[model samples]
Target: MAAVSLVSVSTVKPLGDRVFIKVNAAEEKTAGGLYLPDNAQEKPQVGEVVAVGDGKYKDDGNRVAMDVKVGDKVLYSKYAGTDIKLGTDEYILLSEKDILAVVS
Candidate 1:
């Protein structure tokens, strides 16, 4: 498997059922010729999974496997997750339940 490099810190491992997503920037222009202002841009719901946590533990100590993995491109709920920044890059930390679908 290939590796993804996040912050200069070298490694980022999400905790149980959480995922680290590298957010895709919101569009700058509409389908028409109009350009949008900074504050008017929508938050993008699409992102690439850079890291994923181990599956959550079950009541009997069994692990509930995750559906998403690192490198998967996914669509998430528009309002989910905590937004964070590393240097100039923006990212989101979300739970598996917040991910809507994986992009083919």
Candidate 2:
């Protein structure tokens, strides 16, 4: 009998103009050197782009080129994207339109 091997999903690839971002860690302390509780921490809006999907298709059957690529530091809308937790890392999957700007 032949054994079948199972593969684990270690990487994520966005599809259809979607982007995958690795969220940055939230602030742990305030400027006054006071540690804030988990509930007090705000959701991070900054993240690094890990993967991107092929650009959206136009009505003329032409594919638009994606503006952002891998490893681009970007800022997204506060409530944008779907939060995803893979293993010990946190990620967000959203459309390119949700991305506000690329940080230098």
Candidate 3:
């Protein structure tokens, strides 16, 4: 029999240049004060980095350093990454390339 190890969300760690981000909540109201329905809300493209990989390995066996680290608020590409839900929190896992910029 194979051993099954269950991992919790807090212990989740990305691998090989992948980044784990906690997605921000979608806007419930527009800038004009118009309330938007759940289905009408857009997917958020910004999030805070919760975990990151150890960096990708180059052909020369050198590891490429990651530009983003944990706790960084970043903007990612739209429609990119896999969405994950744990308990009441939402998260996304994506490659470092999908991240567009670090929010100041």
Q: List the residue pairs that clash in candidate 3.
A: none
For lDDT, candidate 2 versus 3, the one ahead is: 3
Tens digit of per-residue lDDT, candidate 1, span 1-104: 12335554237789999998999988999999799999999999999999899989999999999999888999999898888777667788899999999999
The lowest-lDDT stretch of 10 consecutive residues in candidate 1 is: 1-10
Ranking by lDDT: 3, 1, 2
> How high is the lDDT of residue 29 in model 2?
100
lDDT of 3 by residue, 1-104 (tens): 11224555679989999999989999999999999999999999999999999999999999999999999999999898888877667889999999999998
Per-candidate alpha-carbon RMSD to the true structure: 5.2, 6.3, 4.6
Error of 3 at 83 (Å): 0.3
Best-performing candidate as measured by lDDT: 3
TM-score to true structure, per model = 0.89, 0.89, 0.91
* Overall local distance difference test of candidate 1: 0.88
Write model 2 residue lDDT over 1-104, tens digit each, in one string. Answer: 11213311245668889998989999999999999999999999999998999989999999999999999999999998888776566788899999999999
* Candidate 3 residue-wise lDDT at 42: 96
